[model samples]
Target: MDTDLEILLTNDDGIDSPGFRALHDALSEVANVVAVAPADDQSAVGRTMSNEVSVEDHELGFAIGGTPVDCIVAGLEALGPAPDLVVSGCNTGANLGAYVLGRSGTVSAAVEAAFCGVPAIAVSLHIPEEEWPREPAVEEYAEACRATRHLVELAPVRGVFEHADYLNVNAPIAGEEPAPMRVTRPSTVYEMAATQDGDSITLRDLTWETLGAGEVDDPEGTDRRAIADGEVSVSPLTAPHTTEHHEALDRLADEY
Candidate 1:
């Protein structure tokens, strides 16, 4: 048995979600997985932390009344022993592109864990809005779960966590087996447009609708492009605000 392997599972889609359930069951096969996820969908909530949170016992695991980040924090500090890794997602929708990272609660949970010095992975599936069912799509999500399981099995041996704090993975819908996994960077180009209607302003994300039109100037070999080409994208990401030497700042400080 892999006694050394332990994983903390979480998601933005809530505890009752089939996506979370599928991932938890799959992860349990290889690693000791403990799920502590939101009680309700908290997608796009980002890294927001609440002062007070409520937790309830559920059939799958503990349902948390907070953002995705809270679930990871609770899992690590309150649920059980410190896990060897944190895995967030199998999210209902894809969390791709550079701009989406700051807005995706699923990916943010992994980012939060990375900040705590724990290796993490955020897995999401790309689905066209038109194809999305009225209800949650468990079967499609399960396909992504299979990929997640494979990554979990190979993560340790591949040394994926060596240089990266966390990995952001977005897999296209399964057809044959899977196209191929590509190491990529998040695309900077986005299609976030806002419309002002009276006093209320509505923000509409047009990435999906416009991406097919070749309307975006996003470079190739990016997360978006990888998924666009029906390949899995594995973007190794670092924690918030990576530090770099600033000559101008240093000079200013010296003068002061």
Candidate 2:
């Protein structure tokens, strides 16, 4: 463990959430962990930022009345010393697949950190919808907390950031035994549908229903597939968009 390493801990779940506390406790054991997170739930808000956000003092650290991205910026710039790494989540639900990466506030916090030139990791747990209303026991997040801590210990020293800007991690609810971890890629499968009523329409994400039935059909080496197999999935990702020269565009430019 790098005692000198400082970690900025934030989450889409509010600062008071058990998931956030679980991660804070787990990481505090290995590094200097500072919690700068939303005062209330900000899940699925992505990288949305407010020009000015309200900040308040909290037991763990500071709470921002804004999105996860706001917490990252505040933590890095004002709440505390610049962190060696930024870790987000132990999120209430798994942020799986390529489609959700941009929609998850937990992952977005890490993305914001990556753009700041710091390595980051976003962690989430795949809890069945039925399990969400109840307060999850700390023991329930054991596997995810452990996986997150292990990654925090290894990523910086192992030069993981040399190739990837950030990592997205998901774990199933902990069982009696620890789950195995797998390096994975984001599943590209996209499925969504909508239904109409008399005066309204309902948007539905069918992936969860498919996932719950053990029918995802995602191949090996994908995050969704690894999670379905009860393994911790870690997807190394880069933040910036890549571009290539286009001959077709050049020909059009010449014609113009």
Candidate 3:
């Protein structure tokens, strides 16, 4: 409790979400935590950012009326003491795979923190579709929080951030025993489709459907597969898209 390591806590599910509170209280055991999270749910908003947002003081920390990215930027620059780390989630649903990386607000908050030079961990709990109809007990989030606390306390000191900008972590809802842990990579599987019906097109992400059926095509050593196997999946990642010098692109540019 006397440690100087400060943590900025947030979630795409918003400030009042049970998952958020569970993680916040858990992380508080490891570091000083500030909750600069959205006042309302901002799920699947990705890295959508706002130039300005309203902030209010809450019992846990500052609540902001904006996107997850907004909360990260605001927290790092204006809301609290500059954090040693940023932890987003204990999200109600999992955020997995390469295609999903750009569309999950929980992961985007971690991405934003990475760009701002703070190490981060984005967390989610994998609750099956049938179970999602009911809100999970706050205690169920303990499994994810347990794993997160370990990473928060150790990753920095271990020089993990030298290679990874942030970590995307997903875990299954707790059962009688703690779930196993796996270091994984994002799944390469992509399964989005759109169907046109009369006046409008309905878009669907089939990956979640595959997950619900426990039949995803994700291979071994992948985030999706680890979560599917009821293990905590931790994937260390870089943010803001890696740029490489490409002679082919240079030639195409010269032609242009």
Candidate 4:
């Protein structure tokens, strides 16, 4: 394990969330953990940075009245020294599948950190749909936090960032014992639905319902599948939007 490593921690669920505090406590055991996070929930806002934000001192660390991306910028540029690693979340809900990468504030914070040239990890917990409308206790995040701490302790020495810019980690709710961890890829399943009523339309995502039933058709080696199998899912990913060489575009440009 790396000794005396400085870690910058932030989350989309706000600085006061139980999941956030759980992660803070877990990481503090291994490194110098500084918490600079939103003053209130900023879920699903994705990489939205503010030109200015209000900052206040808190028991854990600093709190910013802005999005998760704002917290990362504030932490890196003014609040603290450049961190050896930036960790976002232990979020309230799972950030699974390829489609969710850009829509998740937790993952977006890690994305911003990666663009700033720091390795990052975004962690979230999968809660069953039946558990909604109930507050999750701090103990409920133990497994997720433990898995995250494990990666924080080992990923640096293993050169995980050499091949990947950031990691997206999701774990099932805490069980009697710590869950096993697995390397995985984002699942490709998309489950959006819409309904029109009179002059109104409602948009819904049915994936959560599927996940609750453990009936998603996600194959092996996918984040969703791993979580369904009662294991921690870690998806190593890069930050940049990649594009392959295109002969058609090249021909169009040449003709012009």
Candidate 3 lDDT trough over 10 residues, lowest sum? 126-135
Give lDDT: candidate 2, residue 192: 94
Q: After superposition on all CA atoms, how large is the RMSD of candidate 2?
A: 1.5
In candidate 3, what are the lDDT values of residues 1-256, reduced to their tens digit?
Answer: 7888999999999899999999999999879998999999999999999988999999999999999999999998887698999999989988899888899999999999999999999999888966765678999898999999999999999999999999999999999998899999999887889999999999988888888887877888999999888899999999978799999999999999
> In model 2, how large is the Cα lDDT of residue 69?
98
Instruction: Give the C-alpha miss distance for residue 197 in model 1, angstroms.
Output: 2.5
Report the lDDT tens digits of candidate 4 across residue range 86-197: 9999799899999999999999999999999999999998887778656679999999989898899999999899999999999988989878899999999988899999
Candidate 2 local distance difference test against the native: 0.93
Candidate closer to the true structure by lDDT (higher is better), 1 or 4? 4
Query: Root-mean-square deviation of each candidate, in angstroms?
Result: 2.2, 1.5, 1.3, 1.6
For model 3 the local lDDT of residue 14 reads 89
In model 1, pairs of residues that clash are none
Q: For residues 180-228, what per-residue lDDT tens digits would candidate 2 score against the true structure?
A: 9999999998889999998999997888778877788999999999999
What's the C-alpha lDDT at position 113 in model 3?
95
Listed per model in order, the count of residue pairs whose N, CA or C atoms clash below 3 Å is 0, 0, 0, 0
Q: Model 1 — TM-score against the truth?
A: 0.91
